[model samples]
Target: MTSDRVPVVVAARRTPIATKGARLAHVTAEHLAAPVIRACVDDARAATGARADIGDVVLGNCMGPGGNIARLAALAAGIDVAVPGMTVDRQCGSGLSAIITAGEAIRAGDDRLQLAGGVESASTAPTRTFAGIAYFRAPFAPSGFPDPEMGPAAQALALRYDIDRHQQDNYAARSHQLAYDAHRLGRFDEEIVAIGDVRVDDGPRAGIPAMLGRFAPLFAPADGELNGTVTAGNSCRISDGAAAVAMVPAGSRGTTPGLALVAAATVGCDPALPGIGPVAAITRALADAGVTLADVAAFEIVEAFAAQTLAVLHLLGLAPDGVADPRVCAQGGALALGHPWGASGAVSVVRLFSRLVRGNAPAGTLGIATAAVGGGMGVAALFKVVR
Candidate 1:
């Protein structure tokens, strides 16, 4: 794709993340996504002073009903019926992947605008069964490859990377505290779309640090010499939420400050160590964007599990503190905001928009949004602030 047709994120918004079986438990995936989509489109229209000629609506979703949820959400959002919709599934990476897909379409010279993002409603997901038997998850790989569950993979990563329980708990605590502080200050107010009574994210809390030792390890080593360090407190809560962005070509930016798509990369790693995928993907993405880790002013990597996040940080040489890093998820992450599987990646981008664009950072400021996907893959997108 040519750089001249770069896709600019003209508007971004997300629903308040609610933990599974909480206030948003009854909301369906389409319903959760529709309002966010509508808000983004409305924001873009308000800026351009004309109705957007929507080319398509792209959404990432996992474990929703079998129908095309993107189409359902687009229609529910009141978009023109002529616009088509597409759904993509890249496990946890789905949201970022969808955004990248829309950006690529714009970069390929599609003059019409695009609406893209992801949504998930784990609380209202349909049960899955195969051949008269129930299954918790579909296989990530063929029988010959290792396909460890997310929790065990995180445990193995923590043990392999020497991330101790204390470090994990401290990181989790920091995430919760940051999110709580940001909310109290109304930092997230501009980006959040209220749904019913859920105007604020319900996952973050202030007292997590004091209660660190209460959680027992959910995954432990069989030898018992080193007990499992992964716990519920440090891991992300399953949630229901959606995040979306309105993308237009650079010429259509119309004096709005936005994140211009710079470069993106998706890569694969060993399935047994899926959390490590970000290290390779981020490296390649930075190289592709002609920048280094030091050049990035903001990092919004999904906090699926503290150990996993710490492992990625340690591998990337960004989190020497282990417990806190001001540049990474400065306002907190999925650990405190709740991880709505498919929506978490897009939430990372929305967070970046809030941090870099909405905050009025100087033009050319660099940021990145990345996520470790299930099945041994990672997706990373490099963005730069533009006015």
Candidate 2:
């Protein structure tokens, strides 16, 4: 493929994230994604004063019905049927993965505009069962890969890395504080689309108390010597949400293009310690982008678990200790906003668009959206302000 065109994000938006069975409980995944998809198109139209001419829509989904949720969302949003749609699954990385796919396609000289994002409606998700078995999701790991659910894996990482419960709670508290502050400042107003009565995220609670440490560890192992530091406060909650971005090639947009996709990388690591994937993935992405850590102005690292996020921070030189550095997730992260599986990573991209593209940051600023996925995968995308 020739590099005649560059991938750029023109517009982005998301529905208010709701905890499971909360305000968005009645909506299906496609139902939740439809409005945001429409809104993104509407925004692109208003910005450019012309139809977006979207050629395809790619949506990321996990635990939703097996049928193509992307096609459903597209039709529901009134997108032309001529515009085909596809769904992608990278588990937790599905959302950002979809965006990266679309961006790469755009960069490869595709003339059509693409709308890519992700959605998850845990409230409407059917309880999945193993084939002819009672277990949910799956039963066992493949031969040499040691796979554990995200919670257990985070617990193991905390034990191996010596992150304590207090430290984790402190990190959680900081996340809540930052999210609350951002909400109060209306920092998310440009990105949040209405979903029923919910106008803002429903997960953050300010003033986290000292008593958080008193709660029992949710993922502690019975045989392990360490009391697991991963807790409800320090971990993301299951939620329902959807996010979408409007993208087109360089110099071809009728709409205002914000961030140019400079470079991206998706890599895999040891399954047992999958959280470390960001370190390697981001390193390679930065190298591809031809910049160092100091060149990045902001970060949107998905906080799947406080321990895992802390580990990535340290590995990336953003933190000297296991504590969070303010530059990362300055407005909050999945810890405060909730994690809607496939939607969380897309939300990170929207966050980057918000803080760097529209915030007080200067032009040419650089930002990254990184997420550690289930199945030992990691994705990192580097974006730079072009306006």
Candidate 3:
């Protein structure tokens, strides 16, 4: 919202998302991020016809190695040695949070170019332990609060919102179908930066519509009954990937067709029903941008789980049917592409950049990138195309 020195995304790039313990199993988080960072900076330089002198690198991470991965990633990307880097953790929303933090820095008068994004190496994440016991993940809520595991929480959200298994299956099928089609049509060509030998996403599959009904639900009812609707088929695969964007003040963007940071919001909700987090965050971001759902030409809402996505869309008054609305994810989403936890939010932004800027959308075309976090939170950013 700064009158002067508004933040603009000049270039966006991402490593192909790979399923956990699959194609990217041997890669580390910093290594996964390095190529994408280098590609984005190179893209920005090419666009503006000037060498990039990055001031900082801010990245998000969840289950990667605990050191400052952003600094390591920047070094690996061959950024100047003096450039400082920071890492943030907001669970699944960490990537978007980092980008918004960089935008705020730009508004605070730091005119230097910045690289902001997220990375996750679920395939190589270290096993964590407390005392003598191994733990799968950190508690979303402290003791005495209801912090169900993510799958159960998603199931709860679906039940509470009446999103049935059929609806979830349909949504999942469409995601896979659209993503597969997009890949086949080269829609993701410009945005994907190959990592080593991996050049394309591995999660999207053909014939998903025919296979979805065979999946069994993953969680039980709250009363210990059977037949929960949140199933493996409807949830995003654990993935390894990275996505980053080159950002500068609007004045420095030259004639590039990029997304201008219009507004962003992060909000919290009940940890027990964390899947609903995006509702308030999206509402606040759109309100701040002085626009409505109808005004946005594209939406990239990190589909961690079909049920979660459906609940968010339903609460927002958008039809929950994925195939009915091409605007939500014009190409695809995390459900079909894969969800690299911390990296998914930045991936959403990259998708927006592709769907709006690279797709030849008109100037001032509006887009929203959003995600629901693991621990009762949501993050959303509003963007307007500037050519």
Candidate 4:
């Protein structure tokens, strides 16, 4: 098998986020995934001017009962019945995992053109529900790995990293500032498709509230043991959104060659501290790519919580404030943009690719996208600017 980095190209990308009008009121669940898929395929076809048929479609979705969402989405996109489709779930890493799987398939000479990404209409998807007591007891009785709830996990990370509530609020404030700046500068125009004529992101507000006022800790004890640090002000808001990216073999004839996926890595952490998974994953990815954090031109760390981002930065020895890079999600992150579970990671990748192409940043520019899952699992992928 060829060990050379599989030259995988991001042929196209698209994101349909509800940026205006009642939050998440723009899109329906059944139609949400299909439009993004179609938009991505259309963009890829236009960019490459090649009628390359997608050999397979892999969708990352966390919720939904028994619907074969991947196949349904493909069919809705007018894809031929011959094309195969499959859905996968890896918690928050599902989107990144789909991309990795597609890239590996192409590298292994199994498929050439692949549609890989994720979608989540949080407004429609059902929340996590435990069945009967027997089902719950079966897993833990035998010492099965427990899925740490996101809230407690974030609280634990804040405690371990010593991230104060004020600091987390500050980080959240900066995220809003950056996102606002990006939107004002039209940085997000490339990948953010207006759903039903909505233009700008409506979720991000103009002025970020300072953390001087007293607010209850999200998961702290009632006795006020200084245990509560994670706050709604610093956490990602639940949102409804969908994103998709088209991948093709690199070096394929095209007018505008898309961004290239250079490398990807996923790592597991102590389930007790699920939010720090990205820290380990990012370290592994940088090492694998032989690039330091300084070499990355832009980063799109999923803002699951301000504390999570701060903890990862502290762990990586990055600027505690935030990366000074101009392309780091100039349009804001999951905080301001809203975290739509399965779609957030893919949305970050699409935004990164848009920045690389539209900004015409330096050659070999590195874009890092990371996401932390519910069980202390995280995934990071590195992309190289290839215009």
Cα-based lDDT for every prediction: 0.92, 0.85, 0.90, 0.73
Local error of candidate 3 at 154, Å? 0.7
- Give the candidates in order of TM-score, highest first: 1, 3, 2, 4
Clashes of each: 0, 0, 0, 0
- For each candidate, what TM-score against the reference? 0.98, 0.95, 0.98, 0.89
CA shift of 64, model 1, Å: 0.7
Writing each residue's lDDT as its tens digit, candidate 2 over 170-218 gives: 8888888889899999999999999877798895777554556766788
Q: In model 2, which range of ten residues has the least summed lDDT?
A: 132-141
Pull out the clashing pairs in model 3.
none
Candidate 4 residues lying further than 4 Å off, grouped into runs, are 1-7, 19-28, 127-146, 197-199, 210-215, 221-227, 253-255, 321-328
Once model 2 is optimally superposed onto the true structure by TM-score, how far is the C-alpha of residue 293 displaced, in angstroms? 0.9
Candidate 4 colliding pairs:
none
Candidate 1 lDDT score at position 305: 98
| lDDT digits (tens) for residues 1-387 of candidate 1 | 556599999899999999999999999999999999999999998977767699999999988985999999999999889999999999999999999999999988898889999999999998889999988779988899999999999998988888999999999998999999999999999999999888999868888778878998898753466579999999999999999999998887778889998999999999999999889989999998789999999999999999999999999998796755579999999999999999988999999999999999999999999999989999999999998
Clashes by residue pair, model 2: none
